[model samples]
Target: MNREMMKSLNLKYTKKREVILKILEQSNTPMTAEDIFTLTSKELHMSFSTVYRSLSALTEKNVIMKELRQDGKTYFQINSHNHKHHIICTVCGEVTPIDQCPLHELENKLTQQTGYQITGHNLEFCGICPKCSKQAHNK
Candidate 1:
């Protein structure tokens, strides 16, 4: 978690929400709602619905990024100050961060072509990781 994210989270803080944020901050990769509930429920009392609703609120506030996987699961990660995207593994639901943004030229081009002042952009890349590719080949 970054300072900006902490400052920008405009929602009222609750025990469950604080627990969820701590879990996400400690996590290296994005996790699904079930994962959040399972990890925190052992120490805290929270329902699955409460976890999901908390996720929705956090995402709305941009405290976390909601990633939609090809496997039909939604994952959440802490929204770092760095602007980056993810490359997900379709086989095992792995998420890797891509440190570079490839939208600068494209956003400029589109702005000039369409005369629309583009404010921002989002891009997510998904494919089989090397391990998954090798596993598939061995099979």
Candidate 2:
């Protein structure tokens, strides 16, 4: 799949990029470059800069999406046409993707009223997750 995606993007497929893509594919949530680097480093000989470069290339080609979270760190995930939003745990920094997009109707209404095309949007909710809330209460 990585090879096919890279070929479609006209990117020269490399082992490093393949490894990075595999990592992202396996992840259930978006991950920071550092996280990717740490995981990739355990599997193969790769540098942080190389991971960054691969991420940048993949993101530029729309093979992956780059999201800037509240923590001011960028996260990467495989680009899927079934777009969704994320709810982030403020305390634990856990990001959970919301499968249902709540703004589709709003986006359609706004587009009709404003006479503009809505290409994309980003919406993130921040709050304490259940585990964190439990821990806080216990404390």
Candidate 3:
């Protein structure tokens, strides 16, 4: 999340989106629509349909990024241009951004070796989070 992105987000922010993005931005982990709906509804009176529609619009605008879980639920996070992927918790559904990219060198090499223009790529890593690991160990 850069300053420009934050500014742009604020510029185009709607009341619904503001609430949703605010929650995502503050969250240390990515959240599903149901999670967000529960959290947001607790703070303000909003319908699940509104949250779903807002999330759809935000994803379409590239303001927020979406990832699909194995359980068929969709999670969302702020769209940062820093080129990063996610490490998700299999148990608790937590998500953390991996700062370093595995494809950095590959992308550069591919661009140099071939004239084909590269746009972007998607990468995701899934595993148990620390909290879940601890819980499982205790159990």
Residues 1-139 of candidate 1 have per-residue lDDT tens digits of 4445455666777778889999999998889999999999987999999999999998988888886766778889888855567898888877788878888899899999999998656677889999999999999
| Candidate 1 vs 2: which has more lDDT | 2
Highest TM-score model number: 2
Q: Per-model C-alpha lDDT, please?
A: 0.84, 0.89, 0.79
Model 1 bad stretches (over 4 Å): 1-10
Q: Candidate 3, residue 58: CA error in Å? A: 1.2
Clashing pairs in 3: none
Q: Sort every candidate by TM-score, greatest first.
A: 2, 1, 3
Which residue pairs come into collision in candidate 1?
A: none
**After best superposition, candidate 2 residue 69: deviation in angstroms?**
1.0
lDDT of 3: 0.79
Tens digits of per-residue lDDT for model 2, 1-139: 4577678889989988888988999998889999999999988999899999999988999888998877899989888756768899999988788988899999999999999999888888999999999999999
Which digits, one per residue and each the tens of the lDDT, describe model 3 over residues 59-134? Answer: 8878888877676778787877555677877777667878788997898999999976887777778888888888
